[model samples]
Target: MMMTPADLDAFAIGFMLTERLADSTRDVLSVEPFEAEAGWIVRVTLADRCRGRIHDRVRHRTSDTGCGLCGIASLEQLRRPVAHIPPRPRSGARALFSAIAALRDHQPLNGATGAVHAAAACAPDGTIVAAYEDVGRHNALDKLIGATAACGVPGFILVTSRISFEMADKALVASTPMLVGISAPTTLAVDHARAHGLTLVALARADAMLVLNDPWNCFDAVAGEGLEPPTPGL
Candidate 1:
């Protein structure tokens, strides 16, 4: 995996959990990082209970920063089962908009470099409780997931990048009910989110957001709200 050299511990923990290499944090014993001639390396020690999940498969090359499903050897590997998200009370549009507005304040790294992506965990009322940033969008979300693992999943997760199948899958793995993306979502992501009961929203701004999937009515719908859709073929 090619990722920014920050929050490696979180990345390790999150990667373990999201990939189902370890069922929970209890399955992880330790995460240690060391300097290498090429770059930093993180060594994750999983408990004996997770021994069965370990594999010897190797990637031919480093994963690109924009793509997460890079090293899979077969189409079946990308079809991992997603856990269904239980239904929750509908989140108000006010809260969603509030979170969108507040997300900018939590992105210190992006503010400094103007190149990093951010992922944030927000409360039901739209207060951001935790946030993480990285050059890779997936890495940012992984860091946020690992950072908040002890507290359980948050009300929702917000990302500063387009929602792809991998991003939606990560949110599903974390059991987050809703995922709000600042940009649009891919069609595969929308289909997967609908199938797994994830409330997927995208094209979000301080004023509006488009609801691509809401199988469980996770977001309160405003009848006849004049929100413009993205351009055709987007």
Candidate 2:
């Protein structure tokens, strides 16, 4: 995978969880990074129960910065079943917009380079609890998941990229109830999100957002304001 090498530890942990290699941090024994001839390499040691799964589950591949499913061996691997998210309380549209407004402030790397993507874990009120950035959008989300896993999943996840099926899948694996993307979502992403009970929002701005999926009516507007009407049966 191509990514910025800043947060190797978080990236390692997040990749493990999002890829379903490790259930949680408890299954990880250690994360170590070292300089290599080509670049930096992060070595993650998994607990005994998690060790065997790695050999059968993942196939190393050369992935570009944009594609998320570059290494999948077959169509079946791409469509691997994911568990549905647990039911959670409803969320307000206000919180989503709040996070959209605050997302820029948390992206130091993007501010400097104007070339990185960011993923943030937001509180119920849209406060950014933690954020991570990388050249690859998937890597950024993975880092965010790794950084926040110990503290428990946040109320939502915010990304500065389009919502692909892989993005939705990662959010679901992390058990975040909502995912807000600054750009649009692919058709498959919307379908997967709706099927798995994830609240998917895209084209987020300070004033309004497009709600693609709200399985439990979680993104209700207060006083009939804040969000664009969702498509029927999404």
Candidate 3:
């Protein structure tokens, strides 16, 4: 299916559920688009039976740029508690940097507009498996989650935007162990990452990177004393 920014909020959730268009979960009943005073609204109707519950209307209220949490009604809807991340093997700093460097080349939309955010899932060896882009960082994250949900999580996620609480929340939802950002994280994002045990790395330039939370040893590598000494060449 073709995905535009307008349909992401509705489509992304459906895409992640392992439900296809032939299945009830992703079956599209109808779609209605209308203009509101704020901007534009797209109401999507999925099939009656969807992933255990019947879904009626899922709304995507967006500006021209496709920002996030636009229609949130209460604070309760904003914060969601997630399970702590489990312990896992760490990736070397070199691998992390390699993933970050490779991420730039995958973002054609960002190169053209210079305004969109891109999210990528990279392996421990620094190969990028999937990448998605959107005007909003949250949207990019959601699309990345939907696209890579079945990949059994990756070594880390490389994002081209500042870390936020919602970003951390989404990572936990997707069972991602670590998140690396090109910008710094917010105070709430740090707290959320710590609470959920999701590693948060930010301020990531080519030369340096910061690790906010590393409960799983996903960022730093400890030097061992058992290194072999170099031999002089004759």
lDDT by residue for model 2 (47-151), tens: 898888787676668777765888777767767667657457345777777888888899988999999999999888888889999999999999999988888
The prediction achieving the highest lDDT against the true structure is 2
What C-alpha lDDT does candidate 3 achieve relative to the native structure? 0.63
Runs of candidate 3 exceeding 4 Å displacement:
1-11, 14-67, 83-89, 218-234
Q: Quick one: ranking by lDDT, best first?
A: 2, 1, 3
lDDT digits (tens) for residues 1-234 of candidate 1: 778898899989998877778878988899998889999988998998788766733445677786677876766776777655645624556667888988889988889889999999988778888999999999999998888888855578889999999899999888886888989898889988888888888887877678887776544444323434333333
lDDT of 2: 0.83
Question: For model 2, which pairs clash?
Answer: none
Pairs clashing within candidate 3: none
Identify the superior model by lDDT, candidate 2 or candidate 3: 2
Query: 1 or 2, which is superior by lDDT?
Result: 2
